[model samples]
Target: MQTTNNTVLITGGSTGIGLAIAEVLIKAGNEVIICGRRESKLLEAKQKFPQLHTRVCDVAQKSAREELYQWATSEFPHINMLFNNAGIQKEIDFLTGASGLYDEESEIETNLVATIHLSALFIPHFLQQQKECAVANVTSGLAFIPLKIVPVYCATKAGLHSFSISLRSQLAKTNVRVFEIAPPIVKTELHREAQARKQSQRGIAAPAVAEATIRALKNNHYETIIGEANVLKGASRIAPKFFHNLLNKVATG
Candidate 1:
């Protein structure tokens, strides 16, 4: 898919990987519109990058998701790209049953439901475009290898991984290109700000994922695994037992 001269809408674009992707694509000469739950953050992103079009939408709700799609399409009829990048992660201790039911539900709604719903919402509009169009779903390395502590988060990503595959197959004959970006843990505000900052030091930089994604789109690589995510994919396929045991040990320790 051509990266430039396209109008793109990214959910969770106010910060982290979504913001980084917006920066990269904007620099590459595409018009970028970003939506998030926080109006403050959206305003902040707009302050930093004046060219960005901003919207406040909580994708966890069906109404907000539909409203966003409608507003985006009506306001920017040329929009040809949708990046379902909004997500949240939580550590749930199922053995002790420490996480609330609401938390788990939110993870499912935001990560899996929003991704699928937004893709379905955009495909028809994307196909209507005479030019090439694309939808990129941001999943995680944990989609391939489960981490016990974040079971729901991992499960949602795993579901998203499957959804992307089917969506791509369905759109193969159309003008839309389905892309999945599975990135190794990146320093993002998906967690508490302090924890996210510390994790950022240990994880792959968000910009690295953004750059890799742009490269993947340019090269038409449908499934883009960035950084150490490839290790998770390879290890899961070759040594599933060892990978699970190792991940459990590290997570528990």
Candidate 2:
């Protein structure tokens, strides 16, 4: 897929990895629109990149997702790319029973369900276009190897990975290309809960992931796994048990 001259919509574009991607795409000469739940962050991001079109939409809500699709497509009819980057992570201990699972925002809904729904909403529009289009899903290294502390988040990412594979195969005969980007731990606000528990959060910078994304898109790489994520992906297939134990051991230690 060509990297420039395309209009793109990115969910959760206010900060971190999403913001990094927005910066790269904008610099690459693509018209980028970003939506997030927080108005303050959206304003902040807009202030930084005045060219970015900002919208406040919570992807976890069905109504908001529908509204976002309508508003974006209506506003930018030439939109050819969708980045399902909005996600939330939580550290839940299922051993404490259902108490730990009852949160106002669900990881499954935000990370997995929203991505699937957004893809479904945009695909038909993409199919009708004469030009090429793409849907890039932001998954995690944990999708391949479960992290004991963030079980739900890991599961959601795993589901997303599976969905991306199936979606890519189904769309193979079409102009729409499905890409999966799996990045390892990065220095971002997503790891706040784990950081509060004093877990090591040292990882690559967000721009590294963004740069990898650009390279992947330009090279037509469907599954782009960055940094330590490459190791996790390989280990998951080659030595699942050993890596699973080692990963959780280090995460819990």
Candidate 3:
């Protein structure tokens, strides 16, 4: 990746990790477009970073995803980078799960299916680009070690990791680059309250993950893992049983 002078699209770019990535890319002199479901959040992000292009679209909607693809290709013809960073984390217990109001449908629809759909929509367009083009899949360390509380969320990420590997291999002869970013628990609103409940445990700063992303792209490291994420990824590879036990302990307590 050239790292600058190109256009980038980041999903869920209003706050937390997405906002952090948007800031880093914008500062690096790249044309950046950020999309979120809420217009207010998008406006808030733009207020903070005046140069960021904001789009109000929810990736989980099929029509909106199609429109996003069309708008990007037509308006930002030079766009060459995509960061699939939108996701939702829900605490669910299948034991007492079926409630009248709460459901896990959105978690799967928003986090997993939308990603697959958006990637399929953009892959061909990315291949036709004349410059360095890349599609990044933001997964998690929990993909390697399931946090039993958020069972569906963890499963979706693990499944995405598998899909990314195959997607990369299929696009090996093409101009597009496929990347998987496995991040550890990051200091973001996604799990801030739960983490706060336990003072001894904490997450990596979103800034650290954002900066590491820049470095990873610079070095062309496709499967990027940082900090304690590396430990989880390594443990999944080296000691699966141990990792599972540790994750179980965390979830229970």
Model 2: pairs clashing at backbone N, Cα or C within 3 Å:
none
Q: Count clashing residue pairs per candidate.
A: 0, 0, 0
Number of the predicted model whose lDDT against the real structure is largest: 2
Please, what are the lDDT tens digits per residue for candidate 1 over residues 79-190? Answer: 9999999999877767766556485348889999999899889889988899999999999888999887678999999999999999899989999999999998787777
Distance (Å) between predicted and true CA of 107, model 3?
Answer: 1.2
- If scored against the real structure, what TM-score would every candidate get? 0.95, 0.98, 0.94
- Write down the RMSD of candidate 3 (Cα, Å): 1.9
Which TM-score value belongs to model 3?
A: 0.94
Model 1 vs. true fold: TM: 0.95
Relative to the unseen true structure, what is the Cα RMSD of model 1?
1.9
Angstrom error at residue 104, model 1: 9.7
In candidate 1, list every pair of residues with a backbone clash: none
Q: List the residue pairs that clash in candidate 3.
A: none
Cα distance off (Å), candidate 3, residue 8: 0.3
Q: Give a tens-digit lDDT track for model 2, residues 173-236.
A: 9999999999999888898877776664678889999999999999999999999999999999
Every candidate's lDDT: 0.89, 0.94, 0.85
